[model samples]
Target: MLRKIIHVDMDAFYASVEQLDFPELIGKPIAVGGDGARGVVAAASYEARKFGVRSAISGVQAKKNCPGLIFVKPRFERYKEISTQIRRIFYDYTDLVEPLALDEAFLDVSNNKIGCPSATLIAYEIRQRIYQELGLTASAGISINKFLAKIASDYNKPNGQKTIEPQEVEEFLEELEIKKFFGIGKKTADRMYHHGIFTGKDLKSKSIEFLIENFGKAGAEYYNLVRGIQDSPVRPNRTIKSLGTERTFDENLSSEIFLLEKLDGLVQELSLRLKKSNVSGKTVTLKIKYRDFVQQTRSKTLPYFMSDSELILDVVKGLLFQEELKDSVRLIGVTISSLNTEIKKLPFVIQLEFDF
Candidate 1:
């Protein structure tokens, strides 16, 4: 059976919101991020893109490219509110919606409540409503699976919609650039290019065994993607196994005091989420990413499940203190896992099941 999937991506989300709030900046080149010398671009407006400005680029460098670029700091709270509004719009169609980030999500409208057979039409309507109601523009891609739909969404971007039927998958993929394929990061794309796999057509010609030998686990995925054999589902909403919070700064943190302040914010956010879900966690995980993009995580399991913000922060701070990383920190996150979903009747150090 051909499952209908839709990938909806907001256009220049943070920058677009800024333009929406400040009408005067609608047509101007806008960069939503810190404007400090060491700051990085969080999101760039379409106007900025003409001058080769982009997210993650240094603010100093962005200014060099687009001399008149306007820099605005990110308003995460506003973004989250807008994201909630968008997610509400998605639930109007189907509950089978999987949010990828603040600005993007996948909807499985194959068996929709609206009784709409055409997922493409549903995507168009959703985009229209989002623009009319939220004053935002969105691009949507409709296809038989998540991978193809995600790719199709970018094909016609900035308030555009693109559809890929089952029959056209082969021809559609043939012209696709390797870099445009999902999960193919800069490092993977470089290796693929060296191995003569620069395009979807080139990837299609490679044998599964040859790809597996070169790319390991993802090599088999490359084989499936080239043939448009994506079987991944639009995951239905389920109980969250973990709750976490992360922040990637515009500038790297070199001071321990600054890092501790950031960790305080993360702990507060995690505490609120954990309390809201009524979940206590036994394991606390700290993730750190260096300025050079290298990532590492440290986790500690407690003797008992805890929902205390102070203890969580203390454990994370202890882990950070032990690590002797001299590199400036680019990102930091805290996560709570290993939940204690006890039913009260179950004894400690035992697993019990009773059929009702």
Candidate 2:
């Protein structure tokens, strides 16, 4: 069956939410993140992007690029609430929804609950409703598969829609820059350029084996993409196989006490998140990286899903003890995997006050 995939992405999600709440910020360029030296740009308004201000760029540098750039602290709670509202809008059309992040998702509406034959029509309705009901704009891409749909969505962005029919796929891809291909990053684009591959036409001329030889296993993927032959499914009910968080410290630490303190904090954070999500895991993994960028991981799978911090600490401590570090630690993280979602929710007050 020819799949109908719709990729929907909110335009400048954090900045849009800011503008929604504060009408004064509507026309101005806004950057959502801290303005301090350590600050990174989390999101940028369309106005900011024109000034070369982008997400993950330093706020200090963004200010230099766009002197008029207004920086705002992120309000994650508000964004999460708005994300829930947007999700409800998607569910009204199809149950086959796969969220890529809080602001973007792909929906397979080939057989929708609303019986909408045209995915473009559904995209228009959803976009209009989001604007009318939430005062937010969205960009929608409609095509036969995920890759094409994602590319189409970004074609006409910030309150726009684009659709690519199967017949036009080849022509559409031929004119596209190789960098614009779904999975090609800046580093890969450099390699492509070095190999005389600048456009889709150049990439298409190469055999699957040639690509694999040059780009490893993903080279075959690039070959298929040039032909618009993506067969990946828009998976719904996606399982969280693992959950973890890591932080790169500004200063390297040789103190074992400080390392343990950081580990303790991570354990608490992961435990709270798992409990809140009503999921538990059987594996405990500890990751550490030295100042030299050398990294190592140690993992152990328990007999059953556990939510215990003490046990987690012991496992991590043991892992740390086994490692002989030659340099100061620059990063540390903890992860839990092999998940089980069966959880009983207790009363909020009781749950907050009591233990398992």
Candidate 3:
């Protein structure tokens, strides 16, 4: 039986939350992030987006795009509080919910508690409850699987929902622009264009071997995606593979002394995270992003798992000097992998009957 999947994404989540809390900021251009020259826009309101303001772009650029744009600092705790509330509403329908982030999630309602036969209606009810209970709007996509549901969710933005019936999947994909496909970024789209792959129809015409030869493993994924063959399940309690943190400097740092000082703070942060998660790893990786946007990583594996700040710092210090700096650094991060935490698989029970 075909599974029922719904993808729900809050509209401009961070910015919308700010506006919802401060009515004075409603309907105006606002960005959720620092206003400093070095600050990056964490999220942009729909009004700000109209002026070319977007997330990850420098605050300076966002300000230049919209002179009237207001910058607000991020309140992660508040966001988490709201996210928890939203998840409660999701639980009313099904337990098979996979959170992509604080603002979006995938719900498998094939065997929902509410016994709602129609996934479309479940999505609609979910959106309505969110607006009524939290004063926040959401968009939803309902389809037979996660991939199609995710794409359909974006079809109607801000406060709308779309349903892609299984019968419509083929034509919907065929005419769709290659660039609009999820996971196909600008660079990948450009490469596809060079090979005369301009739409889903074009992508479907290529043999799997041809795609694999050109794009490596990702090419096979693209081939399968175009044919709507994705079978990855929506895992509710996804395993914690790795945990780390990074900082992007306002100004580039060229000296090893300064880099080492930065590494100390990162180690402290990673250690705290490890303690919080109750997990330790044997591998420590040092990530360096140069001023030119080039990234490099150096990793070292130890004989035993370690989560102590001093030991992690020692490992980081060694990895830092193992390779000479190729250029001034713009960002640096630390990651711990090969975790000692065991993964417990969730039992899956087959649905004997479907209401639909």
**Candidate 2 lowest-lDDT run of ten:** 347-356
> Model 3: what TM-score?
0.79
Candidate of highest TM-score: 3
Candidates 2 and 3, the one with greater lDDT: 3
Model 2: runs farther than 4 Å from truth?
Answer: 242-356
Q: CA shift at 127, candidate 2, in angstroms? A: 0.4
Cα deviation of 221, candidate 3, in Å: 1.6
- Highest lDDT against the true fold, candidate: 3
lDDT tens per residue, model 2, 134-247: 999999998888999999999988899999987788999998998898889877999999999999999999998899999999998898889988877776665667888666
In model 3, residue pairs whose N, Cα or C atoms come closer than 3 Å (at least 3 residues apart or on different chains), thus clashing, are none
**TM-scores of all models?**
0.72, 0.74, 0.79
When sorted by TM-score, best at the front, the candidate numbers are: 3, 2, 1
